[model samples]
Target: MDKNKRILSFLISFFMVISFIVPINAEKDEKNIFKEILKDDFEKNSSIQEIDSAEQKIYMVGVEGESILELLDQGYDEEKANKIALDIQNKAIESIKSFKNVKIGEKYLYTTNGFSITTDRNTAKKISLLPLISSISEAQVYEKRVNNVRNILEIASIKKEYGLDGAGMVVAVLDSGVDHTHKDMNIDSDNVKLTEEIVNGLKSKNKITYGKYFSSKIPFAYNYADDSSNVVRDTLKERADFSHGTHVAGIIGANTKDGGVTGIAPNAQILNMKIFSNNPKVPGASEDKIVKAIDDAVKLGADL
Candidate 1:
């Protein structure tokens, strides 16, 4: 296959691998919870930390918690910088008690400036602004909103009135990876077979594209002083949150399949920009990778 075709094939196979995940318990309930709490925060909804974006679990990446990279920037050695990041991650954990789901990857993917957290957004936000965390955006959705809203602005209504189903639209999902075979996604190609026929079928769909924008892996290390492309590529042998990207893709343009859930824009095209990999049991996606995904999306002619 040519370069474009080769890239697309990898994406198709990637989607096939993740889309087949068997939903664990509470999957349905978690979606309801996400819609209730995250319907308002568009950023959170799009973030890797979003509910069900990673097998219905919370996933976070941090640089502020340990401040390792920051310390190195200030002239600290690798050992000292790692020690500092771990220290901050630990202290912050104790100071902000009651924040559950916090974990620091031994390899060091974190949430705050010192380390990463996996707690609810409200608590994370509260702690993030304390000068310890570099940014408050890393928090999770804390309290579940009592009120539930769907398409509150009536965008769906407007789209319907204008007879728009996002046909010819290009939407990007910057997450783990997507399962293209989900019944509700309206995707007809399940290129999981990896045969030439399956590959060509995936290419024909044209609705889902991959590797055209961002690469399967980023070439830089978290420290930026050295290249860890080999390490990253090796880690990527196992990707994380595969279902999350697929879920987001389905939400954007999933067509109705066998009476399954239909997407808001059934005809819109979807792009798979996998930015994270499996780490710390659940696998992880980092912030810098996300920024790169956004750049790739914009360059790929995505309609915003």
Candidate 2:
């Protein structure tokens, strides 16, 4: 009887130890998985502070590195770390209240605190933020009146009379790639064979002259200080960094035979010289690339 009792007690103690160890190990594994996923998402030593506003969530970035890691180490999850970051950001914003002598990075600090200001970092000029303030009440759309202009039927009638139903014109779009497969924009017919293909270095056995691909969505130009050669490329095979050039191309040369809207220059051939992307936050296209594209366009005998 004594031996049986001792064995039972040892079994109970062993089960308790196993139970505690399982959860701890599981939690550790979970943390490791989360860390792996988040490691690539965060900027190097950078933190983001989310500010809750009535209108939109404002995020302040580029917080000091050590402070962010320290918060993470304190058992504060990512959310708590972000909140503390915002607190620090709000403090920095409050420090620039008077705005006597503004430095380069110090200009827009007060916008978080409900003040507007503009600064030219290169020239070191300060401008009144008052003009920057706008309201929906002050907005108005202008409608232009053309003499003897009627409805769509009248335009169609005129087009028919002039025999200008857009028969033999090609427009080249060089913007973000067109949504060729869009329900309203797709071109289908035996005579009008529209092809979508990527323009990178590889060649496929079944070659269709034109098609869509991921690389064509990149921007035509960027203005950052990084070397243009590292980011920009001549062939469409190179990934498009921005979608702006594609969008522009769509506007100027999307196939109109498919009952889509006509472009400003509908008859022109679209030679997409993708040079800039959708949002050109950077300055502009590289000068050499721009010049080369222009020279190629001119050599192609483009009317423009």
Candidate 3:
């Protein structure tokens, strides 16, 4: 029994040794392969600064105009321009051979096939090369209109007391499309519970509770004439179709958090109605669609 136990322990120890040795050899082999590959391709030049690296590519910044001027000064006429270009290109290629990640730009003119150079400084500096230029940080939001609407305090006060802010209300605007991605107008913001729905044809009904748009005058007149030939109501909806709808919508529904523009009711969901002269010259909504939309808004429980 003692001898059998000894043999069993020996076998277990042997297997353990084999397992450890196998993994070590495998890791060593991989390291050697990587080193060999890197040695064959890597080049270092003082003028070429490496900015970023990836497994398959490396981004580099090289002295601009170096190759072009050198070739010209060396008396390589147009006949040798292609050769000179090739040579300079080869130099850049050699520099990046060992780099795991590299991106070249168009101006390099001498990148390997499939490699292109990018000139943006933010991109270049990220990889460790000297920046192409000084960095400037500008506020991305629309500053002019943002500064004009500083009465958010009053708006907030109104919101707290009435719960009347924009809850259960639908404000429609007709204008250039809202920048839905703006910080102020982003769906997650607190000032408004905004929803968007496109009003395409008169027959199609939107699923959302409230919506509106800026439409043209010609369609409104046509629909009115078809129904009763009564020009009066056609003209009223026509008046609403004008740019006034857009301006009113901006005041009533534009998201203020976007830091560009603020609306009187920043929380109202805007419905964009496009009934106008498709050609910007004429502004009006189709009377048929306008009536339908107003009826739809009523069904959606629109406060405005």
Candidate 4:
């Protein structure tokens, strides 16, 4: 085999072994193969920054500006601009996958420059060379900042006085599976047996519906699934995600007849549109999974 083919063979072999033994971590990126192979180029090439082992290996690739600008200059609306940008990003992602034998994690069209894709840093660098791509960098994962909401919304007072607790609303939580047993987070329903006298009296129906995106049959995920297959829910939070979705759901609509903690919208319903999981260690779900979940949520009549 030629030199490039030999390197490809080595990468394929190494990734195949790691894919089996090591669980993927969504927050961490793997070693950059191209950077290692093209160490000299990676250094001389101004496109990619020096490899920082401590940084998350994931990368965000931007779409070329000319396409979006053309759409804008042609008197296209904001919606059209957004659509064109997404199309460009998709093209970039498809080209990268075809050229590099790599998997793209997600695409972001909401970015000002166009869209973004997540891959190991080196694969991102390779993608940057594509004519359609603008730039590639680490995927920035932001933490949801929380400040006191009581002053802005007066949720406690609303619940107490106006009885404005979310009594008739459906909220779809696109996240990791909820614990379904947390005292403060889970709403008491038929599935669980609560010891509290108040909770036992009310025949509360289980509020959360569990759905997994990763374990299901999809070409992007590493999971090998066929017909008659479903992903098992990880209720223990043993995985890397650490119940972020659960916490978000709790804030939205956790209630207790069992004399436990109550969320602001205690009466609201939670739809567990689970997209992220620990099994594959993906940072996030693919574009298709998220789109499908949102479609499902809309069909299910999600108010939020």
Candidate 5:
């Protein structure tokens, strides 16, 4: 009977060991498969060329978290949803900061739960192993496509039919820069206006800095490319679209009472989120900058 008891104990221990090994091996296999898929995706999307492993390039890194829409569907308000995403991004960034060959740049939460990083291909593959990271993709460049809004979309008829003047709405325009000082943009309406002190301050200074010139027409403004609040056009020599942002803003919210060029939604307030660098060599807006602008737009309460 003692011998039978000893045999039973040995059988129990053997089974327990087998169970542990199976699970660990399965988990490892799953991770390996995931990493392989990531590698395929990285190469396919990025069109990566054979180069030194040490060379770095900009890549968009997605984080593991609930998206803004998902959070809202789960009953969180817009602000709370954004905050949660921001927290997830921040935590993930902190966890991976010490990793070699990775440098975090602008972080996004609202529109996209991710951050931009400057890292080489090898480090990016390693980064995919982290539980905090969900995806990695090469950044793409985008150019502005000028549109004839009124003729193409027939916005007047739609506005007339729907009686939509965009009152009580905030519109965010992501472009090079908005000439906020344009007479068409300064129309008086029910939207919030710039404070007297701010106007005086802008007028008194020889140069305007960040966050000082926001008027009632253009409430919130930021230049994501330059990392400044000055959204005014610096020069006209850069591109023909130097006044692109201002022109777009005019189309959306120009409410000149004296028969000036009127926009489709003259009542809507404008939020300036400039993404273009205006550099002749690097003419188009980078994906990272555009993502950052959208993230900021959501945080700043853009209705459109």
Candidate 6:
């Protein structure tokens, strides 16, 4: 009886030790897993007290699921890819509710099973522990790198050599917005430029210019930021709204008819998919926006 009692006591103490040590080991393992996936840039930037003091910062989070491309690569059709995306969104929405004050801003299902979250570092650390979440990194702002335009003659030579006139191809432009009124970009016979009245009408949210002003050159346009189909650059608004897209479109397919830069493929029709908002807080295309744009491009039949 004495020996049996001692044996029972040892077993109880052993389990008690394990119960205490197991949690510590698990926590350490969790931190190690997070450390592996947290990008170096975000890790370095997070050390700054100023950023930490901010109310919230945006983060690009990866979740546990295959992307649309991956699904398609695995022999799933377009319909299945879309369904998978929806499932990922639903799961992410539910998972986000588990964390207090952590909000999902955008869902990226086509490129990755991930979304953007607006939360502080402390909450983000808690979120990282979630079984569904695969990785977390701070959102980064991208600046447009301007380089000297290559000689038009060289582009023409390449086009001539390759016989690539971009005929029947839809080139999607995901930038601030496109100035369809630009003479070089206008491919329609009417050559309709947005008059001040129409511009004012759009500003006032009038229905007059809702479906008009878009030409054959820019056949389709959508502003993802505002969930509107208005991709026309508002002249009355900030310069950023109009400048970048038009410049980019010019370099892509600007017809040299009216003394514009003759792009490499002057025959490609432009698909204006504006991702930037007029709001200064959103500097460039966040990861979610970029992935959304790519998904749109696939659905809309963009060649490039």
Candidate achieving the largest TM-score: 5
Q: Rank the candidates by TM-score, best first.
A: 5, 6, 4, 1, 3, 2
Q: Residue 15 deviation, candidate 3, in Å? A: 86
Q: Which candidate wins on lDDT?
A: 5
Residues forming the 10-long window of minimal summed lDDT in candidate 2: 135-144
**164-253: candidate 4 lDDT, tens digit per residue:** 455444555655545554555433333221223322232122121233222101101111111112323444445335455556656566
Which stretches of model 4 miss by more than 4 angstroms? 1-56, 64-90, 107-123, 129-131, 141-154, 172-176, 180-248, 258-261, 273-276, 279-304
Q: Least lDDT summed over 10 consecutive residues: which range in candidate 6?
A: 18-27
Give me the runs in candidate 5 sitting further than 4 Å from their true place: 1-49, 76-87, 150-153, 191-213
* Candidate 5 whole-model C-alpha lDDT, 0 to 1: 0.64
Each candidate's number of clashing pairs is: 24, 42, 38, 1, 3, 0
Global lDDT of each candidate: 0.43, 0.31, 0.34, 0.46, 0.64, 0.61
- lDDT tens digits, residue span 1-304, model 3: 2443233233323322322111111222221222233345535331222432212322223432234335656687644654656565565445544443444432232121112333332333332222221111110111001112345456445444543334334443322223232334422234332222223342243233223332210111121112222222234444443333344445554555536765544555655433334333433332223334344443333434
Candidate 1 accuracy as TM-score: 0.36
Q: RMSD of each candidate? A: 16.5, 27.9, 29.1, 16.6, 19.4, 20.0
Model 6 sits at a Cα RMSD from the real structure of 20.0
Please, what are the lDDT tens digits per residue for candidate 2 over residues 1-304? Answer: 2443233233323322322111111222221222333345534322321122122211112222223335666787756664665566555445444454433221111112112222222111111111221110101111111122124344334433543422222233332333333222322222211112322221132121222232212212222223232223345443343334334444333345656564322332344454433333533333223333443333332223
Q: Candidate 2, after superposition: displacement of residue 63 in Å?
A: 49
Measured against the true structure, the TM-scores of the candidates, in listed sequence, are: 0.36, 0.27, 0.28, 0.45, 0.72, 0.69
* Model 3, runs deviating above 4 Å: 1-164, 174-184, 187-246, 258-261, 280-283
The CA lDDT at 155 in model 2 is 37
Predictions ranked by lDDT, top down?
A: 5, 6, 4, 1, 3, 2
Query: Which has the higher lDDT value, candidate number 2 or candidate number 4?
Result: 4
